[model samples]
Target: MNRWFAATTAAALTGLSVIASPAAAAQNCGGPDEPAAIRFAFAQLPFEPLTGAKWDPTPVASNYDPCATLSTILVTVEGATGSSPVQALMFHHGEFVGTGTAKAHGFTSLDADASSDDTVVLTYKTPDESTVRYRWHDDRVVMLDPAPSAE
Candidate 1:
């Protein structure tokens, strides 16, 4: 009976460890308003490309989910000349992965469709209007659609 008790206790402890592990804790993407998540997203922005740009104090939109393996924060930053460019900051497990649009250009507006947990559809209101889908694959944010040409 003592041996059985020991085995049961060990099994239970092992299960608890797995539950408390970071991998398990990261299962939920957490809320969009999570302070830590917001800070992480802002810290990852490519400042070189966004020099002299001003963005809202708050994020326009955000999505998080570990099942999808990708998370995102959308921010609209206006340049000194009044050109508003919407930037998609990508993340994986709360770490900044990359930007959805590589070029530094202005778009009239931007929207994100995160209907699926694993991928996000970003639409940009440019002269022609364009859409791009992004996902986390092979440790990076991969654009499923053709990237927009730099203006």
Candidate 2:
């Protein structure tokens, strides 16, 4: 078989489901059968694809948006400082798009919804069984409501 973006064509794009735990931050990609795990290593984020013969990320949740022009991958990573459990990451066309983060407990899952104006609406789920709504732009994630109001 042949593919240009074969490497990027990995897993599903379902929302995340996080449970708060004292255990170290980790990303469960590829299964025990496979042996490749991508660690943040440092606080600095990665913008490229991690392809290793040793491991294949049988990711728990993923969301690939065709509407999103940039070919991006969404993953959760822990901070290098070890302060936060996990943070949502977006890599587009092998370039770092942006990231979304929450409290120390960390975010478990995420889903993106594109708006008519181009802004993306991301719904983040926390371990506490709470939801955070945000308006995502090209470079930042702003906490805002998507509902229309005023009479």
Candidate 3:
């Protein structure tokens, strides 16, 4: 084997192994809004606060865990600008935790299941629009539905 070829192949294989390995645990994992993170655990996200005119908050998840001290609440806030649009925020124990992808649309109706520990599934109904389900993990609320076609 050529000397340079063997060295290059060994280096390439070593790099591939590193890429395939799991990332090291974070000391403090931030929420989904932590910005451009490739990996984050669910427990890192707590509820976030939301404030706006014409906004309404309902504790859909709390219904299932009514007796618990901490509950998940969903808030629908009217957008302040075109770029901002409407915002769907989730809170726990009155503290801001996270936001949903329901931006630009008001989520007037909400339902959630709090049975599973460390996870909550929230569904929202928009007036005359497609409904969306957001999976609430420790760090973020992810939209389960496929986005509407731009066409």
lDDT of 3 by residue, 50-100 (tens): 433554233222322222222244433333332222444443323345555
What tens digits encode model 2's per-residue C-alpha lDDT throughout 110-150? 44444322233344343234444544456655645632221
lDDT on C-alpha atoms for all candidate structures: 0.62, 0.33, 0.39
Best by TM-score: 1
Which runs of model 3 end up more than 4 angstroms from their true locations? Answer: 1-71, 76-86, 92-95, 102-104, 113-129, 147-151
lDDT score for candidate 1 against the true structure:
0.62
Highest lDDT among the candidates is held by which one?
1
Write model 1 residue lDDT over 1-151, tens digit each, in one string.
9999999999999999988775555644443333456566666655536465655445666665443467676666633334666677666766666777766456523344443655777766555566778776786777898776655
- What is residue 34's positional error in candidate 1, in angstroms? 3.6
What's the number of clashes in each of the models?
0, 11, 9
Sliding window of 10 residues with minimal summed lDDT for model 3: 33-42
Q: Rank candidates, TM-score, best first.
A: 1, 2, 3
Worst ten in a row by lDDT for model 1: 27-36
Write the number of the candidate with greater lDDT, choosing between 2 and 3: 3
After superposition, candidate 2 runs with Cα above 4 Å error = 1-58, 66-84, 91-95, 102-107, 111-128, 145-151
Give the TM-scores of the predictions, in the order they appear.
0.61, 0.34, 0.34
